[model samples]
Target: MMRRRTTLLASCTALALALGATACGGGGPVTAGGGDKALSGQTVTVAGVWSGSEQKNFQKVLEAFSEKTGAKTQFVSTGDNVSTVVGSKIEGGNAPDVVMVPQVGVLKQFAEKGWLKPLSKTTRQSVDANYANVWKTYGSVDGTLYGLYFKAAHKSTVWYSPDALAQAGVKPPTTYDQMLKAGHTVSDSGLAAFSVAGQDGWTLTDWFENIYLSQAGPEKYDALAAHRLKWTDVSVVRALTTLGKLFKDGQLIAGGQKEALNTDFPGSVEKVFGPEPEAGMVYEGDFVAGVAKDQFGRTIGQDANFFPFPAVDGGEAPVVSGGDAAVVLKDGKNQKAATRLLEYLATPEAAAVWAEAGGFLSPNKNLDLASYGDDVTRATAKSLVDAGDSVRFDMSDQAPAAFGGTKGAGEWKLLQDFLRDPSDPKATAAGLEAAAAKAYRG
Candidate 1:
């Protein structure tokens, strides 16, 4: 859906300036009024774009914190655009004590700019012990801790209607060759094989990244994102060539790119399961489940199923997921309390609450699939934990914020074009390499 949330610094900076330096209200951290206790009746303002379901989930956790620590919790909900509100607040220097964000890249961006507070050594140890190594890296920048990773959603999977597949006599492809073969089989049967939305470059970009992971491996993908690696490298060329093969071979749905440009996310979702189907498979994150239910009128577990993004020969199999991080503003008080909140949020209990609310995979290693009331949520959560290797957060989130969507979009477009004509793989690879160089320099 291309919904990007905001950063803590941006949310609070604007509010701070609007308050005109009012003695840094929100209790200015817990006072040692009693002389020994570290925390005492502190009022903390927390800003986030959470509302409706997410807000209710957060409220429960805040209420518990307030009761136990005597901290007054006030929420400054920032409607729809989290980044805009956060950016404005950061400019004003009136940020909240804690702000919850969804993307780890934004957390790192703020950290690099000196907007985030360093997490304590104890917090790092706690994180290392409980969360996966992938998340540990996300919270650290230049060897210092700046943020905490929380909920995540795996994207390297294809969602399909099992009923539709059975009806068309198409089996789920276990490998790349199988996927192509299945694509042809489904197409021959008069059903679209794969439905990809290239008009929104983000959608197509994911397909390329996932393919790169399958062809090159995670380490190389990391190097590419860091600009320490060249895009013209054989692996990069091979990945694009593979993508071009998919587009030209009719493996992708007819007019998928043009259709995607005009397709509503929900309506596109309907095409996967609705009676009038344009495609039989969709490659998107777990968030599509909500839209699927709302638009397709088909229950997630009963009508739809998902499989890991297929693997390639000799390729390292790793699952990739993405989620946000919460950063404490440098200007904010309650540093220690804020640290406590971050730590608490990483706990299993907090994860459970988030799962119940947001329907995303929690970073906590102890997330209980049994607690998930819905079968689809449980299955999705199970797939995340069962993944052989954890590759949560895509290349976009892991890449430098400035170079992410801007340059990545161009790569997607070129890949889409190349996907339609596999004859000139070298030229396509060169085009991507040039774009990568420009992004890295910028």
Candidate 2:
């Protein structure tokens, strides 16, 4: 996870996925050989929204790639609005050689516009050897692979403090009803039942997606992602109402919707596990473990731990995943170097580097799980792989950006409104449906 973890990324075969420590050297303009990866000295420009420590770690990985290929890699921080910055760059004919795209919807949009270059044959084979078919489908648009998923996150985990739960005499819930029961118990114990990242609208969307996917099933999830299912549908209403139970009296949550709305992602976790804990649990991806460890200086798997999001409606267990995808742009001045970078990223070695760094997970099945830094990290990675065919990608990510990734104009805004006052699930569903209609139209 890039800390922000607004994430998804991915490819290569025959060439070893294992790598040694990155070597040091200088890179500049040099002639390319006719052989594959003919990149000797070429500057490949890569852009992403990652910053702070997350960006620094990724830079280490890029530096490692540079060591092996003699290609100078420049990393650009795209801020929070990667779409706006990258779009402007593309329009101005300055698209970076390789860009880390966060959502599958946007990647497909890029592919449709012919702005992306397909992965080379070796890169394609590498992807095939490393990731599952579902992951392969994520990078493919119209039967052509346009992106590689590099960093994946398990969204179904619920982080909690055992001491707090024990104080409330509550065990981790295994079902939605059981969760609400536990919530009531915690509230009775005068502690928060949940800490939400309402300020960042994306987190609210994730809340809806997880419950919707776990309860309503994948077919419905796909329908919603494709915009074929209206948000006002019965299943949608049911999902919202179920979540509403936790938000109802403001007694179960650390901060009411108002406070939650003002709290950022990391702040959301801080409310739960901070020195003076205000909440007993937080529902987020595995990245929260990294945030807890890094920002708040807490010991994960001890002070904080996670469990699978409980089931709802007796449906299948939930395993929602999202990550950053790397795409080679057609406008990339150094396509060969960019392709080589993708080859390196697809290997287990690259995933291992980031996984050991914390707050990150890779879907690379071939990577040895032992490389993970801790038991919690290994558990998160293993959870995703064990999900197999039952896994579902982030629903909003698969939708049009206007409906998925937009901060204030689409699902994000609608979900925030729903969080503020979840009294009317039907109204919330209608609002979401109305927004989806407008977003899908153009």
Q: Largest TM-score belongs to which candidate?
A: 2
**Model 2 Cα lDDT, one tens digit per residue, 250-314:** 78777787888898899989988888888889998988888888888888888889989988989
| Index of the highest-lDDT prediction | 2
Residue 119 of candidate 1: its Cα lDDT? 69
Question: Which tens-of-lDDT digit does each residue in 1-442 have in candidate 1?
Answer: 1111122222223323222222222211211112222346667777776665556767766765554455667778876345567778878877777777655556666676677887655456556555667677777889877777666777877888886678778788778778878877777777778776655555666777888887888788788766688878898878877776676665467455456555544566777877787777888888677657655667877787777778876575557777767677777766666765665565454565556654467665555565565887777777776662456467766654444444235565565566445578788778877776775565
Query: Model 1: what TM-score?
Result: 0.79
TM-score of each: 0.79, 0.91
The C-alpha stretches of model 2 lying farther than 4 A from their native spots are: 1-13, 16-38
Least well predicted 10-residue stretch by lDDT in candidate 1 = 27-36
Error of 1 at 130 (Å): 1.3
Per-residue error for 46 in candidate 2, Å, reads 0.9
